[model samples]
Target: MIGRWHGLVIDCPDPQALAGFYEKLLGMIRVQDEPGWVVIGDAPDRPGVALARVEAWQPPKWPDESSNMHFDVRVDDRETAGEKVLELGARRLEGGGETFDVYADPAGHPFCLVAW
Candidate 1:
């Protein structure tokens, strides 16, 4: 069977902040907002990144640590995207080698930026 992933759920302390980070990063907007949840996407009527805030938020350990999953992001300019992401509250997690660099999102979820 072939399955298409719908969206990614990011757990964070502040849904608004995280959602804003992704909204700017992906050129998306807030589609839904609730007490403890906020979703951002290109189209409000379609599926996209879901930022779900929960009590007692804990960040995943990366590099030397393990995480359940991670996503790879394609960008036109890795340097520019890295800078923007950092400005948006994400931190550089890994140095660039040839094609990509790793970053930790606002809530410390690791993802990579690949040049497209």
Candidate 2:
């Protein structure tokens, strides 16, 4: 491969808060914390998630075709994971089945908790 995968970076109003949510959700450790950026992962050298602060950020609307992408997270128990995500400030979204459920993060990025 030309280059290895680094991480998925999300833009939000608060990098720290978003990073904290994902850190707990993904069980990843903080790798870098800066003024407008925060990175979390299994290790410093491994691929993970990054959050970047954006000025006047507008969240993507659910059920809209304008959305570009979303994340799918696999879990052992969908009920437990769904409850945990809601407790962590995620809002449930439409369009999911027995194997998966959709949610929007604090920053309004769409993601799914899947069990399959």
Candidate 3:
């Protein structure tokens, strides 16, 4: 490969705040923080989640073919994890199966909570 995969960048209104959500959800640390850019992870070399500020950003129409990207995080219990995710500012969304549930972050970016 030419270059390594550094991180996944998410566009939102508040970069730091959105990054904070991923930090709390993934139990990661904020390695870099600035006005419109933030990266969450203890190790820069490893995969991280980055948030970039966007003006008047509109969230994607989830479950639609137009929706390009999303995250799938693992959890042991679907029921318990679903409850916790709601507390973490994730809202329930449509289109998921038995082993996985779809949720939207505070910025309305879609992600999946998978049972493992």
Per-candidate local distance difference test: 0.83, 0.91, 0.87
- Most TM-score-accurate candidate: 2
**Residue pairs with clashing backbones, model 1:** none
Mind giving the per-residue lDDT tens digits that candidate 1 earns over 37-105? Answer: 998888876788888877888777666777778778899889888898999889998555688999988
Clash totals for all models, in order?
A: 0, 0, 0
Error of 1 at 49 (Å): 1.4
Q: What TM-score should be assigned to candidate 1?
A: 0.86
Model 2: residues with Cα > 4 Å off, grouped in runs = none
Ranking by TM-score: 2, 3, 1
TM-scores, all candidates, are: 0.86, 0.94, 0.92
- Residues 1-116, candidate 3: write the lDDT tens digits: 79988888899999988887888788899988899999998787778888999999999877674448888989888888889889988999998898899999999998899995
The ten-residue window of minimal lDDT in model 3 covers 60-69
Clashing pairs for model 2 are: none
Worst lDDT 10-window in candidate 2: 60-69
